[model samples]
Target: MKQYTIGKKAAVIVLHQLCMILMVTGVFATGYAFRHDAHENIDIYTLISLAGLVGSFVSLAYMANVAGRKSEDDYTIYYLPIDKVYSDVMLVIFTLLMVFMGKVISGVKNQHFDYASLIMTAGTFTFLFDMAFIILYQSIVRKIKGNILCTHSLMYKGYELLKRVIEKKDIHTQKTKEIMRIQEALEAISEGALDTTLNVNEFHGQQKKVAEAVNHIRQGLMSSVNESLKNEKLKADLITNVSHDIKTPLTSIVNYVDLLKRENLENENAKYYIHVLEEKSQRLKQLTEDLVETSKITSGNVKLNMQKLDLVELLYQTGGEFNERFESRNLTIVTKIPSEQIFIYADGRQLYRSIENLYTNAAKYALENTRVYVELEKADTKAVFTIKNVSKNELDIVSNGNVDLTERFVRGERSRTTEGSGLGLSIAKNLTHLMGGKFEIKVDGDLFIATITYNII
Candidate 1:
């Protein structure tokens, strides 16, 4: 299809050139045949030639228009310095030739051979042919290099240089403004202002693209955060409802299990089974209570009774309570307490529970015959409490190397063979936070460390 179109255009251009040549030839022939007194009486041959000349000239004009339209469609003609120079030179040559031809025609005698007129006519025809050749040559050059012709133009280069020189400062100022705006938007996002949006229309080019991209990121973050919050709320609500519903049935089961244990049983197997049922029912009741507590803490529905409490006394009490459990596993307890009392403002019940959870974690996971270190010290205006223990199993296998221990239901034992609901660390961490304290857990090889810090009062 493309080849056919090219062939059609080539045929049209050829016809146009032929018409131009014919028109030029006709003009030249009439000028050559003219005599000084030819205007007095017109011959039949002259009349026929004149009519042909007018018809050909009309055809040439029409073809020139067609060629011009084709050129305009394919190539853009820029009037550059070179074009101006070429036009001026052509005008000078044509003017000189026309003056010389006029002088020659005026000097010719009437009814003679008219040699001067013939020479002038030939010269005019040659000039017209030269003009046509130059036009064709320029058209080819413009077609090949049309796109880059402006860049190559001296006038265009000068204009560009001048424009840059005049607008350099303005460009720098605009760029600085765009950078500051982008930084401001990023800072706002970092500070949890997801509602902030960048105006893309105020920027141009690459800056505009950057602004649009930032706005998209901000919107995406807003959506993600909202979805996460909604899901968290839903999870909390589900846990709360389920725990409440289970409590009623669990109370009846506990009461019945207790009643069965009290009644005398003749079958030894039945008595053993009833004992097992009582233990399992108690475990289930404790698990339900933990779930309810966790839901309340996570949903920010729990209250704290903040008061001044001694960190040293809390640590001692927690250690004493866990002494028997640690001894059962052949784990030794080492205490590092400062002599001076360090008091912190926090909820006493919550703080004790947080410390108790740490002790429980150490007793459950610590290696047998290993020493567990418990410390309470005052540092500057803060009271720090820490517990470190060596695990019986590989820390990597227990928590998969990097799983957060404080996440709900995340336990150190992968097989979950240990007696725990896996909510101890989570409850502890949330309780510490509620009492305006910091909680962190670190695992290194077989070593596990849990630290809690609060502002001293």
Candidate 2:
């Protein structure tokens, strides 16, 4: 089939070339006959030449269509700089032939029928046919070798450059989206969402490395948090078990101490020893209870019984209960309770415990003969309770320079000379939080202020 197709194209091309040659020969012959006044000989040659020219034109159209179909290779011929130079040389040659033909035709205008005129005319016609055939052949080549032309042309190069630019832009856009996803993942991680992770498979090159790094950080954070939580649970469990174990033996000791006290011993030294045992045992009991309570609060084991309570009544009651202790220390209680009732939602027992801890803290630390100020009032949507007292010791010693007092076992006095456990503030802070309130402590020089705030109902 391929051989047959090639044979067919060759036949058409041969026929076209023959027709062109015939047209050129006939035209020259007719022109020559006309110049010599041979009108009778012109008719048949003129008709033949015209028919051949028409046939050549039809063949040219068919060849052009064939060239168009094979346009994929049209640009292949002009890939090199030498090809351009060759085309320029051909154009110059064609121009020279045209000038030569013009001169020959002018020379033959007034000449007689002879070999000189015949040769000149034949040469001119041959050159004209050659020029026309070269132009037509080059046009067909341009169409058939389109790929080569496109590869070399400036417009084709510009198109390729534009395509590359668009591809680069698309890559950049994909990278930007990956960066944004990584940023969002990082932000979520920062906000304590440890479960957030980056998809490493969705990225490539340096972006994939970044995604892997982010995922590594997230896993590390999750592992660390899990380890920390495990340690916290173990610590809380230890405290709970120890407190329970001590309670059993502590109960027996308390019962024996009570029995010894009721024995009515007459010796003064025996009485003094019993009194010391009772006091130490009580202190130990309080410490044990504080440890257990702190463990429960930290481990989230405590349950709150939330209720609406009047702040004015609660504060007044707390003040009354601690009034005697304050008086004994020569510390006067200065109350600033609002007459209007301020209601807040909280666990009543927890709130009372928190308040009691604060009062105990004040009675233990407040300076002698100084006025302890207590205030309860409504502040916008919240109920604010504040207590201020002058410290018995330097505020620096109590606060320890920017140390958080709410931390477990943190204390006002570093020397361990105080009577109560250091968990009072910690317990109060935890209980306040459990009840959905805010607890704050401020020490200004010799003045210590503690504030509790809760949203009002």
- Runs with alpha carbons beyond 4 Å of true place in candidate 2: 1-172, 396-399, 415-418
The C-alpha TM-scores of every prediction are 0.58, 0.61
TM-score of 2: 0.61
Q: How far does residue 391 in candidate 2 sit from its true spot (Å)?
A: 1.6
Tens digits of per-residue lDDT for model 1, 292-361 = 9999999999888988888888888888989899999999999999987888999888889999989988
Best by TM-score: 2
lDDT, model 2, position 391: 80
lDDT of 1: 0.74
Each model's lDDT: 0.74, 0.79
Cα error, residue 343 of model 2, in Å, equals: 1.8
| Pairs clashing within candidate 2 | 73-145, 73-146, 74-144, 74-145, 74-146, 75-145, 75-146, 75-148, 75-149, 76-148
